[model samples]
Every structure is written in structure tokens, then in C-alpha cells.
Target chain A: MSINLTILGCHSATPRANAFPTAQYLEINNRHFLIDCGEGTQRQMRKYKVGFTKINHIFISHLHGDHFYGLIGLLSTYGILSREKELHIFGPKGIKEVTLLQLKISQSHAKYPLIFHELTSKESELIFEDDKVTVRTIPLKHRVYTNGYLFTEKEKPKKLHIDNINHYEEIDRADYNNIKAGKDIVLSTGEIVPNSELTLPPKKPLSYAFCSDTCYKPDIIPIIKNADLLYHEATFLADKTDLAKKTKHATTKEAALIAKEATVNKLIIGHYSGRYKDITLFKDEAQEIFKNTKLAEPGKVFKII
Target chain B: MSINLTILGCHSATPRANAFPTAQYLEINNRHFLIDCGEGTQRQMRKYKVGFTKINHIFISHLHGDHFYGLIGLLSTYGILSREKELHIFGPKGIKEVTLLQLKISQSHAKYPLIFHELTSKESELIFEDDKVTVRTIPLKHRVYTNGYLFTEKEKPKKLHIDNINHYEEIDRADYNNIKAGKDIVLSTGEIVPNSELTLPPKKPLSYAFCSDTCYKPDIIPIIKNADLLYHEATFLADKTDLAKKTKHATTKEAALIAKEATVNKLIIGHYSGRYKDITLFKDEAQEIFKNTKLAEPGKVFKII
Candidate 1:
């Protein structure tokens, strides 16, 4: 199994000229999941070619305008496009109220089933599960009720090559089935075929944890530990740590600390303050503690191996 | 006095990628007035360089999201930018409730005074007047309670060439002021200066009528007649006349018909349907009926003559 992640936006509460607000796309086993849609997210999707129409599940982190302002517009566009499939959204308790009230006031109704799951942010639990993947909310600490998500791919079945099985000489049908089921086999015609000779081992299940928009919260370490790829909000540098605390945000050092403690394979930090013109300083600050840290720039993709 | 009109968004309820909903920038004298703020308007402003921070007055057409989705995000951004100047917003009865709910929900308390001017939208009356311009709402027909604004510039006084008068002969302050004020030119030396020789004719007061997101209503003709610039929505092609009537929208032909009936100096039609790949067809169609028709594309400015 293989999974890929795309960073849609990475700016903080304030919008900058180049950077957009918070949003990310995670593709696990061919299924696309959207996380923490911000203002202008649809435009970002179009610019990045994220294929929003195929996306069904959307996860919003919190109620901040930078987080959920684009949801209503996107929802309305989907309605105009006459989307018949049910659209699922997982967010805090107030998300439904906000969306419904806006829809009520505007006198516009959605043509699709807009299923909303308002999850409480106090606990970490599985929010969505399907045949291919499972998603769990990573409880976060912020001024508002916020939660992140972990998208983990399900284990792949033991590998089987139909051509290789057919090519095998004098192999019994039952023995071939056993070998395809990850068992060493001896044919009834006195022939033996090793499992590796017939089929290779299944690929590793990939897990992408989006600690999407949270301050420095140590409580989420247990849930997000050892994630193949982790994206966190580093809204400020260490020199402005005081400002981050005052605004209930995270500094680069704090974000790196979380990544280092959780043992995340790769740490992608973003949501930089617009005051700093050079974003490379953010990566430099984060790399001091977590050597695998990198800054999330727009139009760039990070691969998780 | 002159008023420069720019089309921010000209769509009706539907929003497309190239064509935004309903938003316009009316610059009368030196003040900027915003009418019908739609969703993604700030992004539109950024893309078109609308200079939103300089805007003081905002007039919303109705409670539709296309008319006012960008308000909350713009207001929040204004607060973050530390803008302390008071912002005046004019809209219908339900507008205050809608904006206040967004602020309260997001915990966005603007440091600036966000004054609300709730227009009854029941009749035509002067809603605002300044030293340079006067604003009146032209009641229109729509599915919801919607109104358009008539932004007319105040009359200008005669322009006196002080340098010409001083270079030609000695002129007293009293005489200069009198000539500039359109009074009989009298001098202390008993030599009356001909007003024609010293003063030039003042430019005509430029007027712009913003009529958007409204059906082709005959009631608006008298109110917007002979406006230097009139922006009417053309949400569909003439072939979709049935769909236009069913949805309470207007076709390009209908929009041109209204402009022709009102005898507006310049007619700009926009709010195109996404189904139409090219909007040049709209311009061609409208120009076939109304000679002075133009298309309202983003980043283009039209000077009121």
C-alpha cells in the first residue's frame, strides 16, 4: 500500500500574499481526504489540482475563520454542481450550527447529504473507518475546541501473482492457494515452491497523521507518535515565543519539540507569522531540535517514505 | 466631481471561478464605497487590487451569501490589521443579525466601530449623503428582499485659474472668491472681472447607478435613468429565458432591454452563467440591442462620463 500527502495551505490566522491559510490533502489507498479547510481553499484546490469533486469527507479543525470560512462557499458550489453523493464533515460541535444558520439565512439548500459529525475535542477516538483506511481525531489544546486526524491505511492482503502461479510446474491447486495465502508450499507432484519465489511480501501500511492546527500540546504525543508524516503549525519563531503564548499559538521550537518527542519520521511545519519575510528561518529554528524538520511552502509536495 | 466605478463581482446567487457573485467599488470624489460584498470578495479585492483598506462604506444588497459572504472575513482581517477607523455598513433588516452572529461565533470583536445602516428597502429614499456624493436605494424585484444603490456625485463649483488672474493683473482675494463662487466679479479698484475670462466651467457631476442581482424590473427605470454608468446582471443567455424566469434571473437580452429602456449612458452586463464558456458572446449579444453595452471583467475600471 502507498499513501501520499499534499499541503494545500499553511498560513496562520492572518492571510499573507503568498501563503494561504490551513488546509491539507491526504491520499491513502486512492481515497482523498481534506483536512482543515480555510479561506480560499477551493481556489487553492483548483490551483493545486486536488480534484475536490472526488473528495467526499472533509475535516475541519476549529471554528476560526481561517479554518472554516471556505466550507460554506465550497458547500454551495457543490450544491450548484448538483452533487448527489453524501458529503461528510467532521468538526467541533458548533460547526453544524454555523453552517446551518448560514444556509438558513441565505435561503440556499444543499442538493447533497451534508453529513456533519461534530466530535468533542476532549478525547482521542476513531472518527471514520472504511474498508481501506481508518481515521482518528487527535485531541488538541487551543483556545477553541479543536481536533486533528490520523489517516492510517489498512493492511494489504498477502500478495499473489496469478501469472507466477500458472507458470509453476506441476503445482497442486491447494498448495498454490496456501502459498498465495503466505504459507510455504510443497506440491503433491513432489515439487516445492517457496512463498518468496511465487509472490513478494505485502507493502507496509502507511499512516499520515495531520496534527493540522494546534498549539504545543504534549497530550497528543501518544496518538500521533511514529506517524510516517506529520504536519504541525509553527506560527512563530522562538524570538516571538511570548506572542505565540498570548495568542494561544505555537512557536517553531515548540512544534519541533512535539515532533521530536513523538518520534515522527518527518516533520512539516507551517503557519508562519506574516511579520517574518523569510520563511527559511522557520525551518532553521525547527531543525535545531528535529533534524528532519522542513518548512511547508505553497505549491510544494513532501513525500513520506 | 467624478465617480470611477469598478466591478468587483457581478454574479447573482451563483458564483463561478472567473465571475464572482455581486460586489462593486464606487469611487466618488476621493471616497471609496463598496456595494454588495460577495463571497471570496477579499480574494477578489486582492486579485484586482481593490484597495479594501481604504473603503469606509459598505452597502449590502440582501441577506444572500453571494451578496455578503466575504463580510465576516474582511471584518476579521480589518481587526487583525489593527484598523481603528469606523466602518459604515448599509443593508437590509436581517443584515445586522447575520453579521453579528458571525462575529460572536468567531469571537471576532473589531477594534473599530462597525456601524450598521439597516435599509428598509421598501421605497426609494436617500440612504446616505456626504459632501461629495449622495446614495439612494432603488427598490427592485427578486425572490428575496433586495435593493440597488444610486451613487450620484454632488455638483461642483466653477474652477478659477488663480495663476492666470494673478499673472494678467492684480486680483484681490475677495474678487477671486466671488468669481469662483459663481457670483458677479467685482474688484476693489471698481474694475469688474468678467467671470468667463477668469473662471472655467466646472466639470459635470458624475453619477453611477449600481443595479445588480435583480430581475428586469420596470420599477427601477426612473430611478436609474440616464445614469453615467449602470451595472445590471445578465446571469443567462437569451436562449435560457425559461430558466431565467423560473429562477428569477435575467438573460443578456433582458438586461440590455432594461438598459435601453432606462437610456443609461453606459450599460455594463455581467454575472454570467458558468455554462457559457465564453463571455464575449454576452457582450456581442447585448451590443446587438444596446449600443453602449460592456462586459464587467475583473481588474477593469470604467470612468463615469
Candidate 2:
């Protein structure tokens, strides 16, 4: 019933002494998902105490080395650990071939089913749905084919009004299920107690959107509108706006602009360039545009409410 | 001249919290070479303070994930760092295609030239040679095509006998180079001083051999014979001899036997199975056959005499 995120690594392309590349672990509705596994992600997972076996689905934004180089090592470790649970991987086209080729050359065959779901759509589309949450792909513009993911919690059942239910002596204990399901209870006296009188409306469902390694594009605002939380990559500060545009990456101002225009409740910025040792400038610049902006540091956890 | 080896990573297969996979850095004859770059090798290099730009030649024994999964990440880091030096990579066949395919898929073109030398021969052949050192392949028995490398220091110039030079004042200082080259020196009095009397023999050229992930193959003894140091993979103890044979891995006893038969000055055993947490047992088992056996631990350095 809660959405939690753990930042395994947040630095850009190369992993250095204390800075790691991009990797995040999201836990929502009792399920865990790994997003953008860069090199040393497994070590980061271990360092953060994220359960490696709990990661069943992996979502990759693109085929960049900083995003997907750790994939083979992770898979190899799973094989070495003799993991039997099926693992689902979703990414752009050519990921499957690239993964399989590495495995073939390394002579490593995974004991678990490494199911891959290739994404190639240019528009926002639902990619996964379950009873607790729904996942959709937010097509992104980058140097390569990329995708950002939108995770939204499903509507929860109404909260039971204990005092109202206690007043209904005619309602059996077995009828509680029906009351929680938004149904009225029928009494033996032929009187109907409205469900609204016995139960209160559930809280608003929360949603989180992840966007990384993309240029400034207002087209994604509609797809991620009204999200409870949004994570965007800000590789450079405002001064490097031209460099960001040339590299097809976003600046802090651009990321904040997207978050502000989309009306997200809170925004988290990460994927800082290694050249910038101090990240306070990024947060300061981003906050100028979106006051709710936060820096995504490694091992930092955020709750989406 | 001296041959120094730094063990960057020594564990086998999967990288763990403190135990990394196989990677070793060798500084021989004023040249740096990286052997078996496993996952997190760049981080290990940083941790051990090994100069990154000094490594120009990389030798990979096989395509196993534990051996070469870190290559792409390292190459990407080099690109990000704007390294313009050409890197020479030597590995088994299919390495070039695999490396290039990953680069193509990731869209990470190296700024430096990544020249590849695909090795397919199974016989003991000279793979590389320079004025300082000569490298040859030691055919090994493994699950796939594998080769162990032998690095031998080329013969050095004889050391001038300082005291003897002072006695022969008539021998011009310019003739010192000729004396060091093992030529007889003639004084102004026409007295011939034999090369042995004028100059001492050059310190015996040192050599080191690396054999890993292979079974007990006696044929490699001749190639590694009289090596100053030999690093052989001892994946299991004597108790797991059956498993070693089945998996085509060598046991501690087998590695010791090979070292003893090859007459190596020192034997370093590594690539331990994760099951054995305490590696002292491997050293003990190896020392029973070869007295000069040593354990290869992360960050451990071995000096070859």
C-alpha cells in the first residue's frame, strides 16, 4: 500500500571513487522493480541491502553503457547463485540480442527464465498491469531509443467506518467484505444501510514517473500529468544548456520546467555529471523553478504519498 | 629490472561484497599489462591506486563472464575520459565480434582506437614480443578455448664490473658499452681482459606464467618451466578433486603438482570457490607439494626475483 524508492547509484556515465552510475530500485505495492542498472549496480544493491532475489522485473531506459553494462554481470551472478525465479526484463530493441550474445560468448546460461519485453513505441502506452499497480512507458527522446516508466497505484477499496458498522447489529460479520467492496448491507428487517454511510472513500492513489537521459520535451507533460512524484535526469546546470542540448540530455532548468508544467507533487533530480563534484548547485538551480525539487543521492530513499 | 604483479581481484565467478572476480595487473620491464578484467575492475584499480592510463595491452584468457565482463565499462570510461591512446586487446576468437557488437548496440564509440588481436591457435606460440619482454601462449584444458600466457623478460645487458674497470685505466670509458655487451676489453698495454673478467653476467631474466580456469594439464609445464613466478587457478581443495575434474577446474593439489614439476620459483594459487571462505586451506594444501606456494588475495602484490 506504499510506494518507496531507493537510489542505488546516481552519478553519470563512469563510476568513480565515491560516485556510482545510474541505478534505482523501486518498491511499490509489495513488488520490487530495478530501473536503469549501470555498472557496479549489483555492488550498489548489496551496499544498500536491496534484496537481489526480490528483483523480478528490470526496466532499462536505453542501451547506453552506463545504463545497461551491469546487466550481464547481474544475470551472471543470478546464474551463479542458482536463482530459479523467472526474471522479466523490459528495454528497447536489440537488448535481447545483445544480452544473449554476451551470455553465449561467456558460456553462461541462466537457470531462471530471463524473459525480455522489447519496447519500440513512440507514444505513451501501458506496458504492464496488475491488481495493485499499472505500469506504462513514457516514450522519451534521447541519443538512442529510450523509455521512461510511469507507475501508478490502482484504486484501493473504501475504508470501513467502524462506528457506523458497529451500530448495525443486524449486519453479520460475514457482511464486512461486502461493505468494504462498496456495497450496501441488507438487514433482516428489510432496511438497507447505504455503503456510503458505513464506509469512507479511500485516499487518492499515488503515482510515480521516471524520466532520465532525455532532452527537454514538453510533449511528455501530458503523459505524466498530476503524478505524485517525478524523477528526471539533470545532467548539467543551466550554464551548460547548449552542451545538454547538443548531447541530447537535459539541464536542471529543463527538468524542473517539465516537473512544474506537469504539476507533479514532488520532483527528484539525479544523473549528475562527474565533472560537477558539488551537487548543491543542481538542487539550487532546480529549486528556483520547482520549489519541491530534491537531489537524488546514492542510498537516499523517498516515499511517494 | 623486476616483475611485479598486483592482484586487483582474485575470487571466482561472481563478485561479492569484499571478494571480486579475477583481475591482475602486472608491471614488468617498465610496461603495464592487465590480465583478465573482471567486473568492477576499474573500481578495483582505483581502490588499489593502479594508474589507469598506463595499461596499453590487455590479455584475456577466455570469454568467461568472470574474466572479461568489465571490458566494455572500462572502454566506455576511457571514452568519457577522452583517452586518445590506442588499446591493444588480445583474446580468444569471437571476442572482437562480441566487443564490437556491444559497442554498436550501446552507441558508445571509443574515442581511442581499441585494436583487437583474436587468438585461435591451440599450440604454444609467441603472441607478443618487444625489446623488453616476450609473451607466449600456454595451451590449457578448459571448457572452452583457453590460453595461459607466459611473460618472459628479454635478456638484459651485462652489468659492468666497477672495481675491474678502475684497474684498467687504459680501457676508454666509451668501451664500457662494449664490455657490457659481453665483448673482451683490451687495455693500452695490449692485455686482453675476457668479457667475464670485465663484466658480470646480467641478472637472470625473470619470467612469470599465468594459468587459470583450466584442468590439470601437464603439457603446459614445459612452457612455464623455470618461471620466476607462476599463478595457477586452484578453484577447489583436494576434497573436491572429482568436482574439479568434472568442471574442468584445477584443484590445489593439481596446481601445486604443476608448479613443482615446472620448477617455478613461486606458486600463487587463486580463483577460489565461494564455498571456501577461508583461503588458508588452499595455501596449506598447495604448500604440501610446492614449498613456495602463496595465496592470491585481493590487493596482494608479488615480486618476481
Candidate 3:
């Protein structure tokens, strides 16, 4: 199985004519999730061919307008589309109050159940888990209450060696599950076969970490260590470290340093300040510390191996 | 000297790839105003070349998400643009609370003063007035609190008759203001020139009425009588009259009937339902009852004489 991420928007502060604010769509093991819906996110989803119906879960990084302003509009559109499936929302506290107030004043009755999971913890905690993957909150240091998410795929069952299994007469279709589960095949002749002879180890589980709108906090490196892919916000260049520190946002050098310390396989940087017209400077600055650095361009997709 | 209206969006419900929700920019006697900022309205303004700085006043018809969801985004953009002039907003009572709460959560401190005028009157009342134009609210019948605005230009000064002024020795440059103000010119030689002889009558004051998301209410006809141009929402066709009534929206026939009864100079029907692929059917249905009917196409500008 593979995890794919599509960059929906990656600009900072305000949406400009050529740039959009922060939004991303992640598809992991056939499950779709929307992360940090900024203004015009629904339109961006439509423009990028991402179906809203597939987005059952939405994670807001913070309450900032550039992070979650499109949420209300997206919910309203779901009502218009007559969506009946329950929607799951995970964000900081006060999201429910803000959203419900707008819906109440508008007199819009949602046809679907809205489930809210407000995160208030300042520590790393497991937020969601299922058979395929597990999700946890990575508490981040920002001007507001913010939490980044870490997704890790569960270990899969060992693969069955078909040729080895066929060579044994006792091993048949009925024993396929046991062989895949790393169990030895029991023969009627009372001969023992080790599990290593019939099965191989499961492929290494993949992991991804998303961090945005936060300062350079080295504490998170341990939680996100060895991730296959890590998306970090690089709001400013190293020359503007003072402004970045004042705003509690990370600079390109800081993001790259975090990725290097975490030993992540790949690093993607985005959320560029509106002042910088050329985004190439961010990639250039980030590559100074990390070799496998990439820019999170809108509509670009990243495949996690 | 001229009133121009540019239709930014006209679709009724959720925004789609091919259709946008309600938004309009009206330039009346050199005053620019924005009516009903739906989602993505700022982008539409940019696409239509409507300067956001010129729009000092914004009038929201209702609290519906399709009507005012774009307000907060626009306000944030203004802060990013460093607007120092005070911006005025006129809407229902709860608008200020809703808008301010979002701004507070986003930590967006406006560089300009945001003046809010909460309208609660159920009768036609002048909400804004200046030397150029007067704005009055047209109470509408809807499921929620809604108000349509009526903009009327104030009476202008008479135009000077340059040839007539040059022929008379007493009517020099000093007497130009008195002649334009409809005052008779009195000379030192005791020769009296009537105001009508020295200047021509001022052009007739123009008026425009904007109504949307309201039911068929005959009570507003008198308030908008003989309007130079009227924009009324026709959300559905005559066949969907029952649906329109249930939803508190107007049908094409109902909108046309209102325009005919009010004796408006021109009628523009908009807010077309997404179910209807061909908008020509709405125009045809409206024109059957009102001869001077037009469709409010996005980006189309209407000039009022």
C-alpha cells in the first residue's frame, strides 16, 4: 500500500491572485483526509479534482483564518449536497462554538451528524487509530493553540511464499491464512516446518508528519523521528529570522534543521510569506541543510514509499 | 453622473466550478458599494477588476453562508493590504459578534476601524445618506432576518449654460455657483436673469433596488416603485413554484410579477438554481410577464441612465 498527499494550497497570511492559503489532501491506504482548510479550499478541491464526499475527516492545525476559515463554507456545501454520512472534525477548542454559531445564524440545519474532537492537550497523544493506520497529535509551539498530526501505518501480515507452500503437500488453500500470519504448516506426517521457511517479514510500515504555523521547536523531532516524509512550514528565509521569531513561525533554515535532526527521508517546505514573490528561494535555503528538500507547490502530489 | 452595476456571482446555492454564489458591486454617482459577499467573492472582484480599496461600504442581505461567508476573508485581506481607512458594514444584528469572534480567534488585528451598523427595522428606513446618494432598507419576507437595499441618487445641481453666461456681461465667473445652484442672477445694472435662463434643469435622479433570497412580497413594490433598475432573485422556474414557496425563495414568474407591478425601468433576474442547466429558460419565463427583463450574468455590467 502507498500513501499519497496532494497539496491543495500553500501560501501564507492572505490568498493572493497567484497564491492560495494552506490546505492539503492526504490519501492513505484508500482513506482520504483533509488537513488545514484555508479560505477557498473547497474551490481548490474542486479545481484539483478532490471529491468532498471522500473527505470524511478534517484536521485543522489551528484556529487561524489562513488555517481553518474555509471549514464553515465546506460544511455548508456538504449540507447543500445532502451528505448524510457523519463528518469528523479534529481541531483546537472553540471550533465547535464558532462553527455552530455561524450555522445557527444562517438557519442551516445540517442533515449529517457533526462529530467534534477538540484537542486541548499540550503533550503528544494518540487521537485516532484503526486497522490500517494510527494517528497522533504532535503538540506544537505557536502563537495560538496548535497541534500537528502524525500518521503511521500499522504493520502488515507477513507475505506468503507461494512457491515454497506449493512444494509441501500438506499446505493447501485452507492453510493460506496461517502461513501469511507467520505460522508454520503442520503436516499429517508429523514433520515440523519453521515459520521462517514459509513466510517472510512484513514490509516496514510508513510514516508521515505534518508541522505548520509553529516556531522552531526541537522537542518534536523525537516524536517525528525517521518519518518517511515530513512537511514543515518555512514561512521565512534565514535572513528574516527575527521576523519569524516575532511571529512564532519557522524559517527555512530551522525547518531544514528539524528535518535533518529527525532523520526523515524527505522534507517538503511550504507556507511561504506573501512578501516573497519567488518561492525558489525557500527551496534553495532549505537545501543548504537538507539534501532531499522539496517545495510544496499547489496541486503537486507526494507519494510516500 | 452614472450608476453602474457589475454582477460578480448569481448562482443560488453552493458555489460550483461553473457557477458562483451571489455577489455584486455597484458604482453609483462615484460611490462604490459591495452587496452580498459570498464565498470566493474577493477572487471574483479581482477577476472583474473591481478595486477592493474603493469599496468602503459593504451591505449584506442576510446571514446565510452563501451571502456573507466571504466577509471575514475579505476583512483579513484588508488587514494584509494595510488598509487605514475605516470600513463600514451593514447587516443583521448578530453580524458583528460573528465577524469579530472569527477575527479574534485568528488573531487578525485590523489596521482600519470596522464600523458596523446593525439593521433591525422591519420598515423602509434610510440607513445611509450622503451628498451623492441615500440608502434605505427594504424589509423582505424570508425564513431568517433579511433586508434588501434601495439606493437612490440625490438631486444634483443644474448644468450651467456656458453660451448664455458669456452673452451677459453681469454673469461672470463669480456668478457661476449661484447659477448652478438654481439661484437667479442679479446684475448691478438691475437686470434680473432667471435661473432657468442661465442654467438647464438637473438630470433626473436614478434609483436601483436589490432583492435576493426573499419570497414573493407585494409590500415592497411601493418602496421600489419606478426604479431605474431592479435586481430580484429568481431561484427557480414557474414549474418549481411550490418548492420556491416552501424554501422562501422566488420563482421566475413571481419575480417578473413583482417587477411589472413596481413598474421598474429594467428587471434583472439572477441567483439561478444549479439544477437548471440552461439559464435562458429563466429569462424567457421572466420576459413573458415583464417585457424589460435581463439575466444577471456574472461579469456583466449594467449602466443605469
Q: Which ten residues in a row have the lowest lDDT in candidate 2 chain B?
A: B12-21
Residue B178, candidate 3: C-alpha displacement in angstroms = 4.2
Ten consecutive residues with minimal summed lDDT in candidate 1 chain A?
A168-177
Q: Is the docking of candidate 1 incorrect, acceptable, medium or high quality?
A: acceptable
Candidates in order, interface RMSD in Å: 2.3, 1.4, 1.5
lDDT of 2 by residue, B203-303 (tens): 89889999987999998998999999999999999999999999899999999999999999999999999899889999999999999999999899998
**CA shift of A2, model 1, Å:** 2.5
Off by over 4 Å in 2: A169-192, B162-178, B185-191
Q: What TM-score does model 2 score on chain A?
A: 0.96
Between candidates 1 and 3, the one scoring higher on DockQ is: 3
- Residue A48 in model 3: shift from native, Å? 2.2
Q: Calculate DockQ per candidate and list them.
A: 0.35, 0.66, 0.61
Per-residue CA lDDT of model 2 for A146-226, tens digit only, reads 999999889999998998889977776788799999998878888988999999889888888999889998899999999
Chain A: TM-score in each candidate?
A: 0.89, 0.96, 0.97
Residue-level lDDT tens digits of model 1 in B49-94: 7786899999988777778887888888898889989999998886
TM-scores, all models, native as reference: 0.87, 0.93, 0.93
